[model samples]
Target: MPLLLAFLFVSATVWVTRQAAAARTLTFLMTISTVVTLGLIAFFLFAEAIPVFERMGVRILLPLEGEMWDPNTNTFSLVPMIWGTAITTIVAILVAGPLGVAGALFISEIAPEQVREIVKPGVEILAGIPSIVYGFIGFTIINPYVSSELSTGFGALLPIGVVIGFMALPTVVSVAEDAISTVPESMKSGALAMGATDWQTMKSVTVPAAFSGISAAVLLGLGRAIGETMAATVMIAHVKELPQPAYDVFDSGETLTTLIAGNFGPAVGTEYLLSALFAAGVVLFLIVTAISITSQYIEERMKRKLGGEV
Candidate 1:
């Protein structure tokens, strides 16, 4: 009997080692594929955009002043669109960050087990809903409300920011909940045994322990808001110029993603216009890429720290 048990144990060890090696190989291959794909995309974007600089000179599109993106007038300043993207993204993050983290904490720590199961799926379902549907809701419901209450036209920046913030909420909550769940149960138990209240344990122990993951989730949400297109295009007033005070959230404006999606088809006929749009694409790409890289780095660092590899 003893020999039979030893033989089974050895067999299980061998099987587990084989599986681990296969997983490592698969991960390496996937990493290489992703890097190669991103490199190709970057190369193509630059190749398409270089022509605009050559034909019109960088001064035409990049001048800080006298830069209006009037295609008819041959002016292609991107400052307004850039500012619009920044404002909308910043506002969305500010709104989504706290709500998402709180929702995550509720599900992971405060909720009953059965309730957590129900709420988690609902949050994930929100992420799966089409972006265009969210846009439609924003256009039909949010726009009218803002227009009526604020006595402003539809497509104001505040409504767009709020809508995008909602769109990003599911992503932040899902990721943050997963992170909070990964915290060791023993830590929570120890805190409670040491006379800490449930809320105190969660606030001091679980949240701080999972801070990196929560931050990564927020950054990911920000990236999603920054790159949203159809929703922003439909909901935003789509003004091509900057707001009067430049910080006015009540004014309508354009983002890079919205600008590219809305204008790419019509601009295709003109080489310089197409190239200029490609330049905008490059900018959006770089921003999203940077956010993604930062999120990934933080996640990896957190994993290492949790695994005691740091």
Candidate 2:
């Protein structure tokens, strides 16, 4: 809709230019309006929750930071849920990061042109798959296998990490591939001309040149992994406990998204439960916002560096 409005405004400006000489002024006004609209939408997400947090008071943090997450008792300790999110996020990134980078390198640097053309579309299809489909696949295939064969009662983290890793793979691969593809041909040629192997050339020259893009890809994957609700909520059982039962990957644990999702429907009132839910949302919002801002900074730096405008 914004695009359509922008298009119509531009078209109207072009028509008005035939009658008046102030078309440039109209164009600038249109541009500023579009930016304001976008900024309003972005700002609303942060401002909407302030009232909820303000009413709850600092007493809310006691429960949020304490050992347990008993909303009925007016306790709102976020330690357990925070730990679950942090651990799973770390695990998913650890699994997805290197694999995504390698896949990007393969697609851009090593794959034959024809092979790349054929495979790249298929790679993108993975990202287009729905979160519910991933959840179904994890529940039917991975979860049961872990419970029946791997051990007695592990139900969450490892499977979710692996599945989220798969879901994140395409985003990372596509972004990193674009980064690698942008490396100057002269750089690659020079490395090869110096008798460096293809692998060495990619490792030393192409990878470093595209490091910012790869970093953006990893951060994007992190956001995707952290914010993922349906797949993680479905595949992992929701428990309020902090410590992992057995240091086992299969153990059930709750993430902030999972907790928000599973409890929001049943949670209500000015009670601890409702306050805790908002607190969880606050944590998720902060983490995702921080990551997004960092990613933008890296992307801008990369653009300036690559364009030699820095």
TM-score of candidate 2 relative to the true fold: 0.82
What value does the lDDT take at residue 203 in candidate 2?
85
In order, candidate lDDTs are 0.87, 0.80
**Predictions: Cα RMSD each:** 8.1, 4.1
Q: Note the residue pairs that clash in candidate 1.
A: 155-237
Error of 1 at 149 (Å): 0.7
* lDDT by residue (tens digit), candidate 2, 101-148: 999999898889999998899989989999989988898889988878
Once model 2 is optimally superposed onto the true structure by TM-score, how far is the C-alpha of residue 221 displaced, in angstroms? 0.7
TM-score of 1: 0.87
Candidates in order, TM-scores: namely 0.87, 0.82
